[model samples]
Target chain A: MADFSYYIFCAMLLGGALVVLLSRGYVNAAMGMLCSMLGAAGLMVLMQCYFLAFVMVSVYAGSVLVLFVFVVMLIGDVKENSSIWRKIGIVGLWVVLGAFVGWVSPMLSQAAAGLSKTTEVVFLSQAKNYGLVLMTEFMLPFQIAGALLLAAMIGVMVVAKNPSRKKARRELV
Target chain B: MSYLINQTATCMPALLGTADCSYADMALFIVLKVVFALAAIIVIMCFAALSVVAERKVCAYIQGRYGPNRTAIPIIAAIPLVGNFLKKNGLMQLVADGLKFLLKEDPLPAHVSKLWYLAAPIMSLSPILICACLIPFGVWWDSGGAAHPLAAANIDVSLLAVLAIGALGVYGAIMAGWSSNSKFPYMGAIRASAQVISYELTMALAAMSVVLYMGSVSDSPLSLFEIASAQEQSWFFMTQPLAALLFIVALFAETNRLPFDMAESETDLVSGFHTEYGSFKFGLFFVGEYGHVALGSALFIILFLGAWNPLPYISYPESWGWISTLLGFITFLVKISAMIFFFIWVRWTLPRFRYDQVMALCWKCLMPLALANLVFYMAIAAI
Candidate 1:
């Protein structure tokens, strides 16, 4: 049953990606992206990453996709303006991907042959497990990344809130 | 992999009995669970319908108005005392209202996005319906001494999953408003998206505070059942009243109830996002909104109000088994009903907040308070 679900989710993910690439309407693309995210989350659930799956759905489909749709609606639906060359390029990229997958299959098997023989189901991605790892083993890197993000946010605000530029705009008005 | 196989094999019998079931039996059990879940959703829809009537009755009583108590069928009125009581009390109004919705014409407006316009109500309703499975109404201890939850989808990260599902409902309203191709609905949708997103932060944060508290208290994973069981000594509401208050307030906004119902403020936006919607589609939206309320209430009870516990700090014993489970179920239902009543009471009593004021309250007030609460709990936990 899990395998069946995995196959279904894989099909849905591919279908959604195709829809995103091929759909004319922006909202349709957003909806397709939503479907793709949901499919990905289902695959995560199949892997027992339940917390990650829920987080992906909540953050990506729930919030980020809503923002995407909101922006799409705000701008209104626009016809896809891709040239024939771009479409050809996208199709050619897919062909390349397929060829690369075929070529790498043997190499992947060779790499797998060198790996340790550990067969236990590792439920390492549960939220509690994640929290423990983040706060203990990866604490420094996590804090650094957080600080970097905070700095970036502050930089954006400072750039956007230039007093001189605002004064000039106010004067013009 | 073997665990997964074993789970699939034994899951049905774990809840039903100790019978070694075959594939068909397992399939039948799943089918039965799905049926039960659907039935539960229908019951929520019924609750929504009744809540509408109750709202009218409560509002009328408060304002000294008669409301819709006189809409009775003549034949039913001739069945003596019970009929007169039903007629006088507007018992059939729910039937009448349902029929009206069913019989009414659903006209698609010109120049509207037909697909999204039609899909909006379904999108709105689906999240809450799916989230209902995460709620554990009761926990029956079987003869084999294993506790079996009376829920459809029993996942470890159920709280997070439900919240995720709740957040998805905003799309339905946005889709409805934007697809309508009209000014009022457009504004309503925009407001709804903004409001829901903003309040969602506070809602999650407040719930996180509860989670942090539970984590510290019980040393268990952050599941709703774990949190409930942790409250055996004292409910989280008693310890974390501030978070509870923030959760309740944010829930009102999240469900788009009054005081934060900027999405559908009748005065300014002319019935808000559903202005273009009519008939059964509109009824679906209605059911969806009430489902959010009911689900939100259930979450509140589970998180802070001591879910399935008869009294505060007085949890049911596991040794009592089925009797305790039944009482737990009753306790859950009673808590949910009380919470629903509280929602209605607030809706009738308070005035709606202006859109700007609503945003300000969420971002400036509630968000900060929830963050502080989280930090405070974290500090205490660390200590």
Candidate 2:
């Protein structure tokens, strides 16, 4: 049953990616991205990472992809130019990407299984366990990441500050 | 893995065993889960429908008018004293409203995006209903001393599941706005998305504060039932009132209720994202809003108010757990209903905020307060 679900989610992920790449309209592409992200989240659930799965959905599908859809709407509609050569190129790209994924997937699954075995604790992916590991084992790196985000947020504020208002103040001075 | 499997399997009553479970068990479990889920949804739908009537009645009482009281069935009104009483009290208003919605022609404006316009209402309504499944409405212990939650889905991280799924409802509002291709709804959708995204941060932070407190108190994981049980002696609202306050405010915005209803402010955006929506589609959005209010209030009770927990300093004895569980369930329902009434009261009493003020309140006021509350609690817990 789990294997069947894996196939369905993989199809959703791959199909959604295909739609994102090949769809002509910006809104369509955004919707495709949403589908792909949801598929990825479902895959995370299958992998027994429930917290990460919901985080993927809440952060990506909920926030980031919503912003993406809104941005696409704000930009108005984009026209698709469909040509034979573009279709052929996309098909070729799919073949290469499929081959790469097929070659790498087994190795990735093996590594995931090995990690689970090494831990000797299946519920380590639970939120409390994750928090324990994060706060204790990776506290420094986590703080650094937080600091980096804070710096980036400050940069955004500086960049987006009203330049016209600044110029007006300078002129008055 | 077996522990995790059992936790999930409890949600499916048919598959209550381990690897030795038969196919029959699995099939029965799936059927039972579906039936339970359907029952829960129906109960929510009824609540949503009745809440409309309740809201109107409350709003009218607040403004000194009779709202929807005259919408009685003629035949029922023909009856003696009881009929007149029912008619005057607006008891049949829910039925009348449902009939009206069903009978109305669903108008699709020629200018709208056909696909998304049709899909928007479904999108808006579904996530809230799905999130309802994860909420623990009551707690009952089996004869074997195993505690069971009266909920649909019983996974850990129930809090995050609810938040994440609830967040997806924003797309429905956005889709309604953009797909409508109308100016008012477009503005409404933009406001809706921005408002939701901003408040969600504060809401998450506030919830995390509770989660952090729970973690410190019980060393239990971030499950709703666990959190509620830890508050048996003292509700989180008493200790962490600030977080509860922030969460309530954020919930108002999330449900698009008045005072923070920039998305569908009738005065400004002409019904907001639902400006172009009418008939049953509009009904879905309406019901979805109420469902959010219902579920949001339930979550608040669970997180802060001590779900199914009796009064402060009062403990339910384990010797006769069933009676205590029943009392707790009743208490939980009463708390949730009171919260819903408060939602209506606040909606009518307060004035709506300007879109800019809404954003500013979330980012400038609530966000900072939540962060400070979280840090303060963290320090206290550490000490």
Candidate 3:
């Protein structure tokens, strides 16, 4: 039953991604991405990472996708007509991706089968364990990520600010 | 994963099967969970329906008029004092309104996007139902004196689950507005998405403070059941008043209640996201809104009002068994009703905030306040 559910989630993830790739409408694409995120969260739950799963749903599917749709709605629906060459290129890319996956499948399956034999797998079931690891073991990396985010936010703020308007106000004053 | 499965299996072995838990028992467990989920959804839907009646009655009382007192079926209207009381309280209006929604023609506007227009109401309601399973409404004490939460799912990260699931409700509004293919709905959807996104930060931060406080006091701080149980001595509202205040304010915004109802402000947005939606679809949205309100109230009760506990510092007697459980459930129901009443009262009393004002309040005021509250709680925990 568990394996059946896992396969279902996998199908959902791949199907959603396919929908995202193929859908023409922006809202449809966003919804597809939401489905993909939910599938990924389900997989995380199967892996016993409940905290990570919920975070993925809340942050990515919930907030980020909402923002994506918000932007899409604000921009309005614009149908883009791609050249035939571009379509051919996408088909070629899909073939190459499928071939690559086919080539890697056996090794991936072998690794996954080996993983089942491992008795001791590190599991962060509780939220505290995640906090402990972030604070102690991964403190520097976490801090660096935070700093990077802050820097990006500052950059966006600077870019968004109307510098000419500020200068004009200063001159007027 | 095995641990989670085993934990669930052990939690309710009596309901599942024999003492020896097996694979088939897990299937039974899933069925039991589904039944519980359905029950929770029914309870929530009923509350939502009744709250509509309560809202009308409350609004009438506030405005000095009788609301829906005349709407009643003949059979029900023929009763003596009971019928008059029911009519006076506008209880039968619920039945009439429900029948209207059911019997009315569900119209699909020509201009609207067919798929999303149909999907939006279901999307709006499912998240609330999912979150409802996480709430520990009351505690059931067994013969051995051990207490089990009267909830559908007792997951460890229930608080996070609730927040995450609840946030997805924005999609419903967004979809409804966008699919409507009308300017009013589009504007309402935009406002809703922006408002939800803005207020979500404050809501998370405020809830985080409560989580932090619970962490210091309890074993499993992230679990809703544990959080409720931790408040056996005093509710979080007393200890973390600022956080509670921020949470309540954010809750109002999140649920799109009056004073923060930028989504469906009837004055400007022409009923907002559900502008093009009529009949049953509109009814679904209506019920979904109230469901969100009801669940939000239940969440507030669990977080700040001490869940099933009758009052602060007063714990239910473990020795009383089923009677204690009954009392706890009653207490929980009463608390939820009071919280719902408070929601309705505020809706009737307060005027809607301007769009820009709502945005400014969320980002400029509530966010900073929530952040400070979290920091203060962190400092207290550290000390």
Tens-digit per-residue lDDT, A1-173, candidate 2: 56667888898898899988898888878878888888998888877788999999999999988888777767786878999799789978998989998999999988878865345655554788788788987799999999999999999899999899989999999
Residues A1-173, candidate 3: write the lDDT tens digits. Answer: 55666888887887787667767787888898898899999989877789999999999988988889989988897666667787677767766887799899999988977876545766786888888877987899999999999999999999999889989999999
**After TM-score superposition, what is the CA distance of residue B250 in candidate 3 from its true location, in Å?**
0.4
Q: In candidate 1, which residue pairs clash?
A: none
Per-residue lDDT for B82-138 in model 2, tens only?
888878778888788888888999999999989989999999999988887788777
Candidate 1 vs. true structure, TM-score: 0.89
Worst 10 residues of 2 chain A by lDDT: A116-125
lDDT by residue (tens digit), candidate 1, A1-173: 55577888987787787778777788878878888898999888777788889999999988878878777777777978888888778777766886798799999977876673545545755577878867987799999999998999999888888699879999999
Between candidates 1 and 2, the TM-score winner: 2
Q: Write the per-residue lDDT of candidate 1 for residues B84-169, one digit (tens) a residue.
A: 78777777787798899999997888988898899999999999888887787777776667666667666777899999988989
Give the interface-residue alpha carbon RMSD of model 2: 3.2
Clashes found in each candidate (C-alpha, N, C closer than 3 A): 0, 1, 0
Top lDDT hit: 3
CA shift of B171, model 1, Å: 0.8
For residues B195-305, write the lDDT of model 3, one tens digit per residue: 999999999999999899878766668899988888889898998898889999999999999999999999998899999988888888999999999999988888888
DockQ values, each candidate: 0.43, 0.55, 0.52
Question: Which ranges of candidate 2 are over 4 A from the true structure?
Answer: A109-121, A136-148, B1-20, B74-85
Candidate numbers, best lDDT first, in rank order? 3, 2, 1
Predicted complex 1: DockQ: 0.43
Tell me each candidate's TM-score.
0.89, 0.92, 0.92
